[model samples]
Target: MPVITFANTKGGAGKTTAVLLLATELARMGHRVTVLDADPQLWISRWSEMSGEMRNLSVISHVTMASMETHIRENRSNTDCFIIDLPGTKSPLLTMALGISDHVLIPVQGSAMDARGASEVLEHIELLNRKMGMKIDHSVVLTRVNAMISTRSMLLVKALLAEKNVRVLNTPIAERAAFRDIFDCGGTLEALDCQKVSNVEKAMENVRNFAYEVLRLMPVRVVRSDRDGKFLGRKAA
Candidate 1:
């Protein structure tokens, strides 16, 4: 199984929203996903409560630094992927989660251009690499990008990140009402009613691309089991 952590010390950077989209999408693809709701607000846990028993999806709430590794070890038997949603402010858990994560996804708001929070995370990763020699794979996922934004502006954001040698995902998460609606409705994008939600199809496509890119970047070996007729992820020991 692969552990993917979303970290941004700055609040309102859309970290939790990104986590929800990726977790649901991965579960929809038949991979069992366990989300550790480390955020104090417990947004993911609340969303899971609103969401009725989704197959291959589970949420562990009130997670702490001490419990992080224990949750991973205990859930390793059934979990295909572990996603940790960290708090918005800088804390010890931020470093603790990053230390265990296979990939740290730092969500940066597009309109706000909140690079400071993302920079903090990047610096921590660099420090770990330099001081402890721990190389953790990570990326910046641009979120809440306006659909009407100019091509020039989007390119500029890309240019700025590239200038700093930051690796970013090609698929940017667009600002859409459907993304907000999911938190209220408590269901996956595919389950959302097309007539009720506007631009739902486009939102689904964007999330699909994002999830596919992450899967490609961190390829987990999936095995087929005859007993349950479901896939099991194999992690290297």
Candidate 2:
């Protein structure tokens, strides 16, 4: 299994929503997923409480720097993937999480060029690489994207990422009512009412594409036992 952390030094970068989407989508694909709710806000924790026993999914709330490794070590055997949702603001926890993560995803709003928070995360990663020779894999995910048109701000952000030579995900998370509604409703995108929410099918499709791109970056191998057809993700070699 691989540990993927979603982090941003600034708030409202759409980090939590991306984490939820990836965790839920991976679980839906039959991989056992554990989400560490490292954020103080407990958004994912509250959502998990409301979800009530989803198959192949688990959530550990109130995770801290002290307990994060313990939780991962304890759950490694059962988890196919571990997704950590770090705090919105800069924290010592960010460095600790980034140090251990197989991949760190920094979510930047596609509509705005306010990548200051993302820059902070990038700087930390660079410091780790320079000071400790730790080459941590990471990518910028353009979130809250407008599906209709590519705005000027978004293009500038893309250019800035290119100038820095940072990898960006091919799929951008689009702005959709369903994405917001899932936090309020406390379930997967599939669980959303298609009739009530506009463009739910499109939202689901966008999530699928985003998840697929992530899987390409840090693939998890899953297999089924002969005795029980349940899928089990093999530990990363």
Candidate 3:
């Protein structure tokens, strides 16, 4: 299983939102997903319950650093994908989550303030990797971006990318109220009313593509799909 964790050192960086959306998308695509909520706030846990798909979804809430490693070791065999929703700040629990993650996705708003905080988190991750001699794949996902505001910040982000050698996914999530409004309803992006905001659909596709790229980088196995024995080729990373 590929264990992906959504994390950042700053609050309100949209880590929870990214995890929820991406996990839902993967689940709808037929992957057996297990979401581990490592945040003390338990926002993702609450949202999962509100989504009313808990019975069908594999979601474990109120997980802390103390218990996370054991849980993963015990349950990893049964899951195809493990998506961990982490707290926004650095803590022992957050560090533990990163230690075990196959990929660490840091969602940042397209703003200088958010970028600065994200850089700090990246530095910490690097330090940990060097100290422990463990390779932890990491990337940045830009969210709540608008052409008007992003035009300038995007340039800043590009400059940082060049200087720091950080990877930024090509897909930028646009600012939309629909993203927030859909949480109360039970569905993934595929089940949303796409007619209202087609852009969201495109954004989601970008996310899925980025995820596939991460999977490719890690060289994880892509399972083939068989619908009533009509075999489809292995899914491309």
Candidate 4:
């Protein structure tokens, strides 16, 4: 199973939103998913509980690193994917999650300030990769991007990090009220729109594709994709 941890050193980076949305997308694609909520805030956990019936996904709260690891090890055999929503700041739980993660998705707003804060998280990942034999996959996901801002802060950061050979997913999540409003109602992007707001629809499409791309990098089971690039399975794997 692939274990993906959404982590960052700074708070208010949309970590919970990313985790909740991504997990919903993955589950909708038909993959057996288990979400481990390491944040003491339990935002994702509560959201999952309130949302109720998810087809093939399960969400559970694990406050400590030890418990998280134990859960991963014990349930790894039964699950096809594990998505961990971590706290904003560094903690023992976050460290343990990183140590066992197959991939780390760091979501940041497309701004100079957020870019600077992201650097610290990137540096720590680099250190972990070098010091330990762990090969943790990672990528930077640009969030809350405004198209009017011609100068793309995320693109600039991607250029700067090119020398390090880090990969940035092509799909940049644009700022959308749909995303912001969905949290309160516990709704997924897929459930929100069918015809209107094409941009938001396309953004959700990109998110689904990006999730598959991350899975592909890990050499996990390739999800069958149709001509439109949408995964054909009930969930992504």
Give the per-residue lDDT digits (tens) of candidate 1, residues 87-118. Answer: 99889999999999899999987433467788
TM values, all candidates: 0.92, 0.94, 0.85, 0.84
TM-score of 2: 0.94
Candidate 3 Cα deviation (angstroms), residue 142: 1.3
Model 3: per-residue lDDT, tens digit, 10-63? 888888777777776666555667889988888777777777764224778988
Cα deviation at 144, candidate 2, in Å, is 0.4
For model 2, what is the alpha-carbon lDDT of residue 82?
96
| Candidate 1 accuracy as lDDT | 0.87
- Tell me the tens digit of each residue's lDDT in model 4 across 1-237: 778888877888878887877787777776668999888899887777777877767888865766887888888765677999888886777667878887888887866666665676777777887898666778887777674563556667667657667677666666776667566666577676556534667667767876666666664663534545454443333
| Candidate 3: segments with Cα more than 4 A from true spot | 54-56, 147-149, 193-200, 228-237
Best by TM-score: 2
* Better by TM-score, candidate 4 or 2: 2
Worst 10 residues of 3 by lDDT: 224-233
Q: Which residue pairs in candidate 4 collide?
A: 29-234, 29-235, 29-236, 30-234, 30-235, 31-235
Please give the range of 10 consecutive residues that has the lowest summed lDDT in model 1: 220-229
How many residue pairs clash in all the candidates, one count each?
0, 2, 0, 6
RMSD (Cα, Å) for all candidates, in order, is 2.5, 2.2, 3.1, 4.1
